[model samples]
Target: MSFNPFSLAGRRILVTGASSGIGRQIAISCADMGAAVVITGRDPTRLDDTLGQLVGDGHTAVPADLLETGAIDRVVAASGALNGVVLAAGIAKMVPFRMISQAHLDTVLGLNVHVPLLLIKSLLAKRSLQQGASIVFVGAVASEVGPVATAVYSASKAALLGAARTLALEVAKHKMRANVLSPGYVRTPLLDALGNTGAKIDALLDITPLGMGEPVDVAHAAVFLLSDASRWVTRSLFIADGGLTTRMSV
Candidate 1:
């Protein structure tokens, strides 16, 4: 058989937030690429649904809220040693800067920032992460464009870029790589739930060049990064917003 650089055969991966949206798609994609995936989400029923959709066996599902004490340890234990991990577990709240409350701030930041960092730390201390492991953090274009009413959500995602880049360098000695995947307005239930109707929801003056994308679109980029195809790539932002960033950056 010809060696496929993109193949994830025999690899083990852990995907957080696998209950729905992009995270669930990543887990499914990993399995389709031949990876043994460990999926976790706060919702047990939805997580089980995601596990059932996986293409292969050796997949495990563990439901736990990241905010609870010892939650990271439990998740790390369930994942075992992993070749790749996707930190897609996050929550977004669209509150205006003046309207932001301490409660909302903590909730969003705790999930989006605190949990991912703590989870990575646990994976390291427990040695659950294999050498050359790829760590992908699910970020957002909101960080770049600063969408209105997304003060906290934007800040939370913005934190991942700096952290993931530094993490890439710190883990380089072990051949480990870290990168952030930023997606624009993806048409998921979460997307529909956010803003409902407003330009602020999209943060784009003009229509998105290719319009909104599907979960599989981001999953394809994530699969490439998780596989050996992105071995030479690290500390980069992989934007899968259908040219939204390209136009905005220019």
Candidate 2:
């Protein structure tokens, strides 16, 4: 019995933030599942590195600053029609309430919220989305669980969840699906930037009963959401945080 429900053969997927971390993993995973993927990031070198790692044919690298909202339409035009999109590009910053400024809010929200929303609008406007298209937004457990000095980041993520829900409803008539993949502390460059502040790492681990998650852990979930296997699964938030949110009080 050959089970091929997860096969993405003939599908064209565009993955943002594909240069590194979870986005990189998702691009590789999607390619492995037989999708022709377009990997996008600001770093051309890193995007090329990811493109090289893709397992199958038709994978391409597209370097674009997603922060440039106007460029989103060009990105869609370059990639052609998209069957799926993984909006994985984002930034995380830790700033206390007193230290938070308009710049901080704009940077965080621009990347996390504004970019994804505008990208979707551009993609839809191009009429490039095929029926049954899936759009997966990478969210964070921080949206629901509180962490010190992550108010801005958390708010941005929370906004994604809300936006995805509404977008799901609006796009359903077009036979397109939208959802959020929220992950906990996965081993990524963002986490590495946090550094080992003595007990901070240990404290986080203690709260997460299943320990730290790897990039592939979230990547696999992304694959499921992108593939036809999850055709009925839209307007939902799939939490892949290894039970971290369940253990935490926030």
Candidate 3:
């Protein structure tokens, strides 16, 4: 008997932060796997660009900023029931600890931590997540690496890791799964925005044996977590960092 556990046919998924970068790639990859994808982002134009790139039909674009209190509710309400949910929307900045401000902390934590948590809450309230559905929270290697100038970013991602683990236990009764996907350095606009120039990337290559990863690299790992292939997987943090952690640990 032939079997392919990764097929997402007939699955309906909601992917947040799908306007660009990792989230955009994840949305495209999920659609490639035959899932009906609903992608959300604050920029309607970028979301439309992503929606246009998706392979299959029945995909939707809902523009909403997760930082807003009621925005998530509207997203879930429009999505209907979902077989998977990928919380890939996040904010990152390289600000020195000495320069960290209250506003900075609030903005980082609000979007990275509170938004995803509240979004999940909204989904649950609306019964938008089907039984056996999978949840994927996109964390970052900064949480584990403790890099310089990423105090709040690391904390926010660490909070997500902790929350996803707890959510896994709490949602067991619903036959749902939750996990975190932590990636090292990926080539995205966000990375460029973080001031990672070619020189910086060359420096990073020294520590990361496989060099910088692509958005699709992280997206593939997310696909596994969101697909039936990971039916028995939950409360796990899947690191797709191309051996950065391994090298750093040595």
Candidate 2 runs further than 4 Å off:
196-199
**Model 1 clash pairs?**
none
Model 1, stretches more than 4 Å misplaced? 197-206
TM-score of 3: 0.96
Residue 131 lDDT (model 1): 93
* lDDT (CA) per prediction: 0.91, 0.89, 0.91
| Tens digit of per-residue lDDT, candidate 1, span 140-237 | 99898887788999999999999999999999999999999999888777887785644455556255798878999999999999989999999999
In candidate 1, how many Å is residue 185 off?
A: 1.1
TM-score of each: 0.96, 0.96, 0.96
Q: Compose the digit string of candidate 3's lDDT tens values, residues 123-233.
A: 888788999999999999889988778899999999988899999999999899999999988989998887652225556667898888999999999999998889999
* Preferred candidate (lDDT higher): 2 or 3: 3
Clashing pairs in 2: none
Model 2, 87-149: lDDT tens digits are 999998888878999999999999999999998998888888888899999999989986788
Model 1, clash count?
0
RMSD per prediction, one decimal? Answer: 1.5, 1.6, 1.6
Q: State each candidate's clash count.
A: 0, 0, 0
TM-score of model 2 (CA atoms): 0.96
Model 2 residue 211 distance off true place after TM-score fit, in angstroms: 0.9
